[model samples]
Target: MKSKFFIKGVISILLIFLSMYLIDVFVTIPNNVSIKVNEIKYSFKGKIIEKFAVRNTEPTHLKVLIKYDSIITISPNPDLVDVAAVGDSLYKPANENYIFLSSNGNIKKFFYTKLSYETRSNKNFPREWRNKWLDSSMWDSSKEIN
Candidate 1:
């Protein structure tokens, strides 16, 4: 009778540990992505798991299910741009920022209109705005722009 009770206790303990391990595995969070523009840095945190649902195709583009506060923008390696609003997928850029989507369902290149001298002359221009403009200029020069 004592032996039976000991065996049952051991089994119960094992089961408890196994349950905890499984929960940890399933609930693990993904690494966050941080982007800094000028002096301001923004961070987006959540899980981005890639599971093979279909046997043939490549992971159906990794599912980036994120739970973030405010607006979150994700730029995946190579060129996958996703914008999330209130923890939900809002927009996925068909092309990069420089390549705008036209009403005709075609991609169009956007030329950078020169910034006026007055605008650049603003001594109190916010650092964030300046950084955004610089990033835009860099993107325009890159091959991925179009």
Candidate 2:
């Protein structure tokens, strides 16, 4: 009886580890696009994880801090600082000062930003793809950001 219980405990531990690995595989939201904020472009395809945390809300301004790993290459990485409301899985803007590019696609260039300006002098960018999420107006009732 004692041997059987010990063996079962070991099997349960292995199963727990295996399930954790599978969750990592499935829970990751794919971020495979190059986004251009102002003129400089930054791409985080298979790079940083896209977990944004919203904080410090005022009547006119809001702050968004995107959680990601240490960015070693992507210089001047844009933080989600001081913007209007940004919903998940949609370009759902809270006010007129913001826009959301679809989490899909390979390229998103921000031609306008009301918050902070990019001080980088470089004009080079990754190849621009057709903005597929430009007309995404329908919000999914089942999915939400908050």
Candidate 3:
């Protein structure tokens, strides 16, 4: 009798944990990222003076140092790190969550909302979209607005 109860308890606990994991992966994280995308809007426009990776961090943080009106740093997506080159123009509008990169007269726009939605729907979206999002070959200056 005692063994039966113990087995049931363990099964119940396992089911609870599985449900929690499902909710976290499917709902919680995605909603949080979407909220952050809508809430946090940083405005900066400048030339990328430097790009470096902080190797000391757990997942090495890639950073872009910009200068124009004042100095500021941006930790963009890993894909952006490669697309953006030193001397390229970087613009983040105050009203939106778009990161625009203009390189040699060609421009690429990265929308945080789309990234968040992609992350919510597919776990491998980032890796799959890597190099595709900001590839220099796909850059178009006229199509992208400042």
- Candidate lDDT scores, in order, read 0.36, 0.33, 0.57
Ranking by TM-score: 3, 2, 1
Question: lDDT by residue for model 1 over 9-45, one digit each (tens)?
Answer: 9999999999989986666421211112211232233
TM-score-wise, the better of 1 and 2 is 2
**What's the lDDT of the predicted structure labeled candidate 2?**
0.33
Q: Pick the candidate with the highest lDDT.
A: 3
Worst 10 residues of 2 by lDDT: 114-123
Comparison by TM-score, 2 against 3, better one:
3
Each candidate structure's TM-score, on Cα atoms with residue i matched to residue i, is: 0.24, 0.27, 0.46
lDDT-wise, the better of 2 and 3 is 3
| Model 1 CA lDDT for position 127 | 30
lDDT of 3 at 5: 100
Can you write out model 2's per-residue Cα lDDT over 46-127, one digit (the tens) per residue?
2222334344642322222233444222212132222222332212232222333343443343322321111111122122
> What are the per-residue Cα lDDT tens digits for candidate 3 across 1-146?
99999999999999999999998877675535444443335577778777776675433223344553566666665566767777888777764546788898899886523333333234433333333333322333333211
Q: Model 1, poorest ten-residue lDDT window? A: 30-39
